[model samples]
Target: MTVVVTPLSGSEKLRLREVFASVQDSGSLLGYIRTYGFVRFHLRVAIGKCIDSRSVSKLESFIMENGLLDRVEGNANVHRWSEQTQLEKGDSIAAGHMSELSGYTRISVTQNNLQELKEIWDQWGNETKQLFYGNYGNLPYLLDVQIDERLFRALAQFWNPAYNCFNFGEVDLVPTIEEYTALLRCPRFQVDRIYSRAVNVPTFWKKLMAITGMSEQWITTRIKEKGECKCISWDALKGLILTHPDETKSVDVFTLSLYGLMVFPRALGYVDEATTDLFHRLSKRVTSVPAILAETFRSLGTCRKAGAGRFVGCAQLLLAWFYSHFRLIDKVVCRVFFEDYSLLKDIIVSTRRVNVPEENWIALLQNLQSKDVEWRAPWMIPGEILYRCGSFDWVPLLGIWGAIGYVPLLVLRQFGLRQFMLATHGLTQSEFAYRGADYKKRVGEISSAWNKTCRLKGVAIGPTTTLEYVEWRGRRVNDNIPEPDVEGARPMEEYLQVMP
Candidate 1:
């Protein structure tokens, strides 16, 4: 007998192929394709994405195709309430209460009661067993489950025996970051901004951990240092500021230094003489002035060698110190290196240029990004002009120095560069590279905003936008864009592009 199987229709085969294609498109479904692909069902996919109007159609189709919806029982009003509800599904006490006592011989009417009890037992008996037995091998669970402490309890009050299975005292659950922050009105979880958030205990603890990078030793040390004054962290630092009221010495010098080394450069309105003083005091406490000076010199030398120029990291620090306390920096620089080196000469030249306006300063920095060592000496020229301008524009420029120059070099040397970059980038877009078209748009926005600010402050600023002297101006006045000869003038695009 020759037996031949009929070929599948073209449309049927196409539909099957389409179903397989959809299944394979889903990564999860494709993972089990070889084993589960043969047992195909349309219900699963339809239910997954179908919602609202779509969901109604899917349900209707399912019911029509399955032919079960018509016969299925609808509502039992399971949410309904009654006083008889005291007889829970599995409560034997309820069954007993409902039973009637007979005067002579009692006839059992247990059919309904047995059925209800069976239903209750069937529903939850396996659940109870599974809960207690599933992970009994786990020591913590086994000790609690295996031991029948209630059976061994001594009698108390009127009872001959007392059962003591449940512990009644309130449990002190560990606080999560959110819980702790909420309690303290501070931010404890991951955040893009900390200044606006309230610092809580958990947030405080986390900050302490991040700053100290210690689980036990550093915390203990801080606690001892802080004494009963406060907890050992930024919160403690703030608390000290609140409590001491007089002594500047107790102000968290370490925190100030870390803040100096970490945050200020990337954020605007955060740099100030007060914060700088705090940083200075902190650094002096942690590292001697002479040591700091030495490191600064060393860093300057390294940058000089790297062809990145001298006034990058440590040099900037040195300059910052000088700016902070001119008399002090002058006194120290003259006392230490005046006789041997032209370091004082260079500093004096740089100091003379400190009065330059912020826009001019930023322009100078943009110029410095490309120029060689020879072009850097002229940097002091812009600084002198700025100083002459008596521009307190120095404040924002300090942030640029800290974020772009000092912080990058500092973290890179320590190799914790990623976190350093993350913190800086989170503070401001300017701190990170937003290259290409995004960068152009950002620079343009910044330029316009800055011009508006300068105008509002009544500060005299040269035009930021240029009017090209093109032949297309056929209507009236054809004037060329006026260009101001700032110390280091570059093309607008060149001036705006951030250095990598």
Candidate 2:
């Protein structure tokens, strides 16, 4: 005999709810599962209904045996009302103009001349390139990424500042620290030695002197003020990369320029003072992943809330991360997975440079479904997740330019674990810059909080969520599930209309 589990009809749903209630009252659901072999049926019927805690273990075993875990984990219902409310609150807090942002603001990306950097890199030998890669990973590949302005604009619209992930239709996707670290492939990054703002930071010229071994006179003369911060022109950096006596110093200057122009380009054609501070710390073996992610989230949140602004974060890296999740490239063969391979290089080569219309991209993202998202990036195989701050609730990240917070518990499904409604009460409160009166105190507090980060080890088998977690997700107001837009037309109608 064969068994097929289908969606329950209205009457069937009512009957299943009553059955579950009676089983909970009698505490015989575990006995029922073992005797009747109705495990799959009951699991399917338990989507929004509460399951008896007594039967959870048996149900988990059955789910694992039948390979039905993904289906059960992915069946979360979309809660539209909660998503909208959260978005509004986040926007109000960030920009104070939520009512005016009905349509997305046109995004302005940094126009850095990476073609010049790539040309300079192309002149280096394999040994020289390897030396550079040893410190910075495959950062040079970012030069190959032709910025897709329209796609990024559309992509920016879906960024939910409330949760720090892209909420497209019914899907939730965020670029995690682990994913960025792997993509960087830099051997120098130590996960535990993260970057945080110090109470007393060194001057930009002094930091530059330490990095380049240049005289204080040389560094101070070259530094120019750009807006509120100081910067060194690319011409000065280029001269050092080409004519500097020491090969190591030349490489260091080149890497610094890359971080400024490519990764965190606050000012075009120059490396910012903040970039120098971060690069100085990088020399001390500090992990750049969290700082990179923090700036990325901060910039996206700023742009999203204002409904428009120039994106000051790394566009190439963001686009690369975006393409990895949405595009269907060739599958990775077994050998490549075990051997040395560059996932960022693959993404840059595979992604086409065609410019899709901004409206079309927006329409497509707005209509995204669970089936459309590749939850886990193929390159990501995390052994564990940095889920909490020491003993605090969620992790807080401090960037060179600003700060923000994210809840790793909210995104467990991205790591192939089950999703749940995690507590996020104080996350938004942590979002601020280094300029406020209490900014120093806030940074000090967050920096201390990082000392006690708690990690959850990856599980090989069994359900990732508890009975209480599943129940909470089912009953929670602000759920992660995607729902129809306010207009209530067919979900794909707008998408199709905007497509070529």
Candidate 3:
């Protein structure tokens, strides 16, 4: 679905700020609360809950599923807590009283208490599952099944138990030139100016995963290398990738190189002195940076070993990435490549003739989203995530207000029920995309109060709009509205009038 930015009015900003803060305080926003304000502890807890003998077991399976886990040893896990403690859901046991019940019962192991400790899932009892589901407003019950799926779509990338800390989910894409153009062009300035939601986002780094079709290993490895450092120098980053020259290194190479180019002026603010200087020095040698970006992806596509029509996979990855931004990014992941390409009018990169069938592209889209990923609620909660005082194994379901239970999802925690709303299309229109099962009418009511009350841009995000590639002129074009140039750009519907 195409992402459209629904601007919020100034008074609406105040309302949203209040709503966001209040929600954060409420246990209802378990994901946001866990991720923000002393998040290291929470992330550590999330990782700790995931990274264990079970994680080790999972890693072995992943290595079999993927390639080797890693050649080098990853960072050591030194932060210690009692592995044998039983953490209750929401309720707490006194520190002094902890030792008294240790022998009686405790959630000693990870969430492997109910079933075999093979995977990350914890079994949920119907009654307890219903109770916790009600706590989060019964997300699926409250919203359409699509909303639940959309809410949790891209989370597996960030919260896999295998990699532990916020990580990337492997997209398993085949790569495309047009897709790369859309990616490098994702308007950072407009998104930053308009959408005031996520920090350290707005940059195209997250979106780059779609462009290069890189693996998550590359991302995690880069995370280890980059650490708290947000920006990277082309020389160091490109040098590291080129030097490694392994197939796997493509992940780090493709993701970081493009990110460095897109966020150029802001580079100095986030990176070290050496990193900033490298970009400045390199830009002198390069007349057209965008050309370099286009060429890079073209080369990536050619190198990929797909039988034929490799660009189809690349295009699909880009579309999937673009559609996901609707659920992931707070605003439209505007197809800024046209605008970005305009900035480099002097440089040009020619793409191969487009001959892939439309069905192939459509099929890839289905493949990326074909599977359903589900999780049990509150098991991801810190109450259960953190080690508590008694109870081998976490509970699968509540056992008379017991300690162990099933796991909840990070994606659902952050996006579902606890929605960050924008304005409706018109003064009277209510955007129904975020409307859950019971909340349809209320969204419009809230929007009306927005303008009468105060204004943050005062724009409205409409419902899910489809962004498919229609053959424009000769090249395959992907955008909400199609325009050859970023100036006076509009959706591609008019251009398709010429098509059959």
> What is the Cα-based lDDT of residue 336 in candidate 1?
19
lDDT, candidate 1, at 81: 16
* Top lDDT hit: 2
lDDT string, candidate 2, 41-137, tens digits: 5545544444554345544444354333232222332122223333444321233323333355667885788887898899988888888988878
Q: How many residue pairs clash in each candidate?
A: 15, 5, 36
Off by over 4 Å in 1: 1-203, 206-239, 242-355, 358-500
| Residue range with the least summed lDDT across 10 consecutive positions in model 1 | 155-164
* Per-residue accuracy of model 3 over 1-500 as CA lDDT, tens digit each: 54343343333332222223222222223433343444333323433343334433432343233222211111011001111121222112222322211111111111101111101012334554344322211111111111112212222112211101122221112112222322333322121111111113323344333323445555334432244345434444544544454533333342334323322212321222222322222212321222222222332222221212212111222233333322222222221122212211111111111233332222222223212111111111111111111221110111100111111111212211211211111111111222247443443333233223110111112211112101111221111111123343333222212213
Between 2 and 3, whose lDDT is larger? 2
Cα lDDT for residue 140, candidate 2: 90
Question: Which regions of candidate 2 are displaced past 4 Å?
Answer: 1-102, 327-339, 460-500
Alpha carbon deviation, residue 437, candidate 3 (Å) = 61
Sorted by TM-score (best first), the order is 2, 1, 3
lDDT of 1: 0.24
